[model samples]
Target: MDPLLSLFDPQVDSDSEDIIITETRSATLLSQNGSLPPECEEGNIEYKLKLINPSKTRFEHLVTQMKWRLREGHGEAIYEIGVEDKGLLIGLSQEEVNASLETLYLMADKLGATITILRERIITNDEDNCKARKYTDHRPHKCRKAVEVLVRKVPDDQQTIELRIAVLGNVETGKSTLLGVLTQGETDNGRGSARLNLFRHRHEIQTGRTSSISKEILGFDNKGVPITYNVCRTPEEICEMSSKLLTFIDLGGHQKYLKTTVFGLIAMHGHYAVLVISSIGGVFAGTAREHLGLALALEVPVIVVVNKIDITDNRSLTQTLIQLETLLKSPVCKKIPVRVETEDDVFTYASRLTTDHIIPIFTVSCVSGYGLNLLYKFLYVLPPSVSVNDRQRLIDSKVEFQIDETFQVPEVGLVVSGLLISGLIREGDYLKIGPFDCGLFSPVQVSSLQRHKVASRSVRAAESATLALMSYNNDIDLEKSVRKGMVLIEINDNSYGHKICQYFQARIHVLFHVSMLCPGFQTTIYIGNVRQTAVVVAIMGKKYVSTNESASVMFRFIKQPEYIKNGSRLLFREGPSKGIGHIVQVFPIITKTNDNSL
Candidate 1:
């Protein structure tokens, strides 16, 4: 076993670890110098050409900075000891390296963080000339050796850091099979026996095609090793024992279920997207390309998975990879393809994924379990990309929960499940659910909350959970009143009066269209979890908007009013026509009522 492999890599090491990179324009702060980009003030990645013995005050300041980096990364930080602040890979001497590592470990101990030397790199000066390739670090002559390390400490306020990744690809691309192998501790039998447990519908089981959204969770312990059924008897036990949770939203890949796929991408609020491309079936099948386009339009970062390598011939696999790489490099995607082939590559790319526009592509087989270890290591180290300030704002904002599914449990009353858009919620909290037929909200009490089938003390911002609800005053018929696409929010006032929107304005860019889009054009509109049919009422400064054009358009929902918010991402589509926008303003239809509407 290699010393560089961390506990989560391939084989387990007793040692514990990216300074997490955020997905924002923060990287623009860097200035390119030669080939290395200078370090920025923000983000979890810190570059130190060398960390040697420093004064007492200097060491304290270094510790403080590491603390902030950990917070920004939601408890993870990356320290490149041999890298310069300006991104130069200058290796230090063996004596200097040891001293530098001592300083780093001390700094981590001050903040209760765990540290691990992730991997090492050898840098050679141009002066080394022809012998650079033959030089080794032990010689300590004409060569520089650098080391990369990972620092980790779980946040104090939360037990686990949660991340949502949406799985998308064409039908029969082995999406479910890959997820099943990852979540369950089992390999396939070359007959797709692994994916059978993930099917949600009778037709899907009969046809082996997913037609609805299904969810599977992968848990990792604090040291970053995966926790599966082998370690825990049940998922509830896994949730309790793990420190990081990844929720994979599995969506339908067939064209007939495109709407369902869109709803999951928008409503689930996924932080990352896994675009699966089958090596044998090739890239152009079912809705593979369309799924990629949707993920791009929604601004979700993507990781491409090339599955079914065990069954594909080398020539076919090469051709499929070339085609997939070409599609990724297209103007619309404009993403660089980074192939993950080793443990070192996995650690390097995963730590920088959120900050870079490069997409990590993996080749894996469910039956043989080839390349799965590398993928797991990459995912285990990946952190949530949302910045700290943005997360705080969402937590401080008013509570709003979007309903994606409704169910009737025998023991429990009405059970509504979805993502919590903002604010915090606890059991027994009173919230408002509605904008019903006549446009009014009714009071409802949260009886209990369950996250991943485990009883939750509370659910906070950006977390998904199912809440058991009981009608306040028992006046509303829970089953008849609650449905999908509605919201549950907290009302601070006694005023029963509420308003829903029938009209809204958005700045949109037309991606594709059969013809010019003009007034009275009807399309399916998706914003968060709310899906409705809306007709374009007017286009400002233009009579009609065509493909590749941008405009401000006003739309009115045809069927009913919806509770909406300003600045939400909006997508509209009809047949093959697709356009994306954000709500700039909303026109509310105020519904004044002393009670709930049915």
Candidate 2:
């Protein structure tokens, strides 16, 4: 047995908060020498000491069992060969291991899946154990080995899997450049040449800083090979050829554009966040820390990228890494920092990124392309935070599409691009879009749909698309009726109409407030894609609140009544004062009528 296996505690509670408990348990099980039946499995993992030979019926049963395990893990499963079900690592001979792998491949073939070997270790016993061996050979024999394999089923419905990653950091941290390098497959010239294509406006190019939210894509095929502009020449081509798509939300890092960054993070529904830090400059600047805090508060899984490695010296790089590790390990973050130096580290971390505690740090230089391949591999294997069942539940629920950007094309009429937070939206579906100054949703037809610049018939929950809207019933001007922060919801004839209101109550945590938060204290509030000024009307159960305090507060929008949902995340900020909370209750609007009798 491996010495590491001796430290394993089989009786430890599986529900512990430690994210790596699963991996540890797997390791411990693989090092044991006992065997148990497959029916005794308790988790997504399964063990097989060896499968060199099996009856036809047994093989079929094993395939069926693997199918069930795959379903439990949502199309992903792990298999430990040369390990017994009783958590024993009974190593297999080289021939036995080869035959077992071939059998596993056959099983995967039956389920239309692919397998990747994660690790292989040789188990060697000491001479004292060899002396007690009952083998025919008198010489001390080397023990057998074990292998850990990951089996991933190719999604049959959608050709490609989508993962949105919000890229955030402080100014000059190379967020845009890193994205450009990843998506365009071109190294930077060290003078902002790579980021030129990602810039939206002339001002951004002139200043060499992103001031608004931009997006770029990097695609990976089923085999985990990147399909960038170098191979496809266009995004549409990449989408057509790739089996997985990674959407990078390139957000501004400047303090002035912090609101835009926050909106991108919230509205985009990013599965993970990639925070870039400069090795030379370090994270001493408060903006980097602020960005990290925002991601943490939102509960977004983060992967830190220490950039500018080609330009920085060893001392500077080491110092920057130390600072980042300290922050991640601090009480506020409490993240387990794993420095990714090899492809193995990437695979291990990517498979476990959903735990929200493992923070994988990567060191890369856009100019020299150091560690870029490892980053791409990591992204290729990173599973989405949301599962298929969750998405299905949203699809079954009422449709709620939050508008993030509105545009009036020359001939296309009005097009609103946003995410479908719930339910399904088809091209011909008629929905109510609103909360204009009049505080009501008007009927509109979905004339067309486009995702990733490719025309599509429909969009599903958690998917982003631009929907062209046409006036229905009322002769509504879409440009005037639709606005950012508004929602397009499916109409239900049976229920009381959707509520719109200006006043709402929220339980807020004052993350940081320079002064006491009293009644009438106003700040810019952001809920989803909606950004509006709101004033605190009342503070419940408290005279006043300040930093690190919590209170239930009544807030009224300064403008019109906005369509807000219950339990929606709300972020309010004024200068350095920032607070994050969620809507707890909403008050309905009451209209007064003219009374002739009075």
lDDT (10s digit) by residue, model 2, range 1-598: 2111111212222122223211221123222333323424643578887787789999999999888777666566778887656655556778888999999999999988888887776665654334223421323465567787878774565556788999989899898999989988989999988999999999999999999888888898767789999898777899898877888999999989988988888888898999999888786553677788788888889999999999989988998887776656645466778799976677667766775468899999999999998999899878756666777788888888999999899888999999999989998998877766766566778999988988888888888989998886455567866788888887652221335678999999887665799998999998888899999999998999987778999999999888787898998888767788999998866433111000
Error of model 2, residue 244, in angstroms: 2.0
RMSD of each: 9.0, 7.6
Instruction: Tell me the TM-score of model 1.
Output: 0.88
TM-score to true structure, per model: 0.88, 0.88
What lDDT is obtained when candidate 1 is compared to the true structure? Answer: 0.80
lDDT of all predictions: 0.80, 0.78
Cα lDDT tens digits for candidate 1, 36-102: 4677688888888777888999999999999988877878888877666776656667787789999
Evaluated at residue 502, the lDDT of candidate 2 is 86
Model 1, C-alpha of 97: deviation from truth (Å): 3.7
Global local distance difference test of model 2: 0.78
